[model samples]
Target: MTLRLVIFDVDGTLVDSQADILASMEAAFAEIGRPAPARTEVLGVVGLSLPGAIARLAGDESDDRLARMVEAYKTSYARLRHQNGAASSPLYDGIRPLLEALHARDDLLLGIATGKSRRGLEALLDTLDLRRFFVTAQCADDHPSKPHPSMLLTCLAETGIDAGRAVMIGDTSFDIDMARAARIRSVGVTWGYHPAPHLSGADRVVEDTAALGRVLDDLLELAT
Candidate 1:
């Protein structure tokens, strides 16, 4: 099967932005007088939409209070993100080479499915000069979060590619689950936030960006 498209998840799979995210989230929680979860715990919430993630953090709170907490988080995050001397995030090593190799393939198309808002993704893309590589993007703004298959299906609809000809790549079970639910192939990555076993459902897992690129041919083959 000739793979028609590869949809990537932004934060963990493409760039290491967790430090900045964590810092901003922490400040947000602190300002609301709600303690933030530990960094390791926050990692689990990375791929979910804001409401979903906030629900996980707010636990048994009433919906109205949860809404307030979400607003507080937003207010705090808006103020702290990209401020306070936070370091800029960078792409994982070998990403450039990987993208270059894939871009050279005429049969392949690239897209992004992320929990990030469209504005957030555009900011990162513009900063990294990676906006040109993708032909489509399905962000958190448009639909329900991962494991729901909303974004993956949106990508398929946009690109006119069936699930059988697509592959989803990321570092979390959310990615694998979404692809599985959508009946597409999934590739998981190491050197990202998730634990290895979290990606057990992926068709294959790669340890680094170089290995990820090398395995794309095989992954695409299985998709077809």
Candidate 2:
């Protein structure tokens, strides 16, 4: 059996966090006495770091205001999670089963490469009881945000997995581009924030978890 690493993006890939994300964006902008960006605008930046996302939405804003918005967004997101518990961000359908099946494979290792901050990723993992499913988790705290290769490179370094033997699974172009930069294969999911058309660069684009599993099996050459 060959060892392979499977890296996942968190927000739109592993969990459906759109509601909390949009709500937090609204709260953050409200805290700064600014109107929130449109829902489509917010969702468009779903796979970037909070700072990057906010910067894109609030173009040309002062650095101080951007910092404040980031802090306010964090506060609002934490509060929402506390108030709603796991319900604030639930795993997508069929995801848990797929994760369990993958985690059980002796030749496979699971990891995370997300734009989420360390604190935010930890909270989600703990809430969903998903920490055990991954062997390594690389987040925004230590690396440049998505679309950069830092996170995936670090996952490869930590796991000693060859780039050829690893695959990145995500919903956004940021994820696909990151994997490409890292010289790894990518599997894009369409049921997340990004539409299917945006995932054209991916090695494979899956519509659901079942299709995702099959693509992974094919990409990683796993025995069926």
Candidate 3:
């Protein structure tokens, strides 16, 4: 009954930000006279840090040009934020219910560990009315990006929870990598940005919401 923390990723695992992400990315590419990658290709890089994702999207461009593209992306993203970011964004089906179910568990504490800015995450959470589910969060702006484990460590620090008892639920190798680096258990979601096979490092992978709920239940069982 002492499973005190559950940290989640944002882009793919919670809110499906693909529409705005792709639109804004395309706007970035257009400024550089390049084309946006298809949705499938973009999904492959969705979980990366913004700079990292920009690097991949820059392809063979020179450093200076890539930097320009990044600047363009930032400007475009900001403009897009208020106007279109949430227009097509939505919480994954069952996320609210799942959070509600978990929130009712007195021993569990919900939080977020994501490569998004704290303001950006807060905006999305407010849009979806999902902020109440979290008691703590660590966003990319708070620390170095995934695979560094600093964000997760920060979550542990701020929440005063143990890494050994926390479960990191996310959708990409970066997420799993973070969990493993932090020595915490990871649960991968198959429906998100990364394929299940690529999430091999996770303690387990769940196919859907029902399965995810079951996985959480089992983890709590072990914790108790």
Measured against the true structure, the TM-scores of the candidates, in listed sequence, are 0.91, 0.97, 0.92
Candidate 1 local distance difference test against the native: 0.82
- Give the per-residue lDDT digits (tens) of candidate 2, residues 1-224: 67999999988898999999999999889877999999988999998888999999999989999999999999999999999999998999999999999999999999999888898889999999999999999998998888999999999999998999999999999999999999999999999998899999999999999999999999998322
Name the candidate that leads on TM-score: 2
User: Who wins the lDDT comparison?
Assistant: 2
Better of 1 and 3 by lDDT: 3
What Cα-based lDDT does every candidate model obtain? 0.82, 0.93, 0.82
lDDT of 3: 0.82
Candidate 2 differs from the real structure by a C-alpha RMSD in angstroms, to one decimal, of 1.7
Please give the distance, in angstroms, between residue 96's alpha carbon in candidate 2 and its true position after superposition: 0.5
* Regions more than 4 Å wrong, model 1: 1-3, 75-87
Clashes of 1: 1
Pick by TM-score: 1 or 2, better one? 2
Off by over 4 Å in 2: 222-224
The full ranking of all candidates by lDDT, starting with the best, is 2, 3, 1
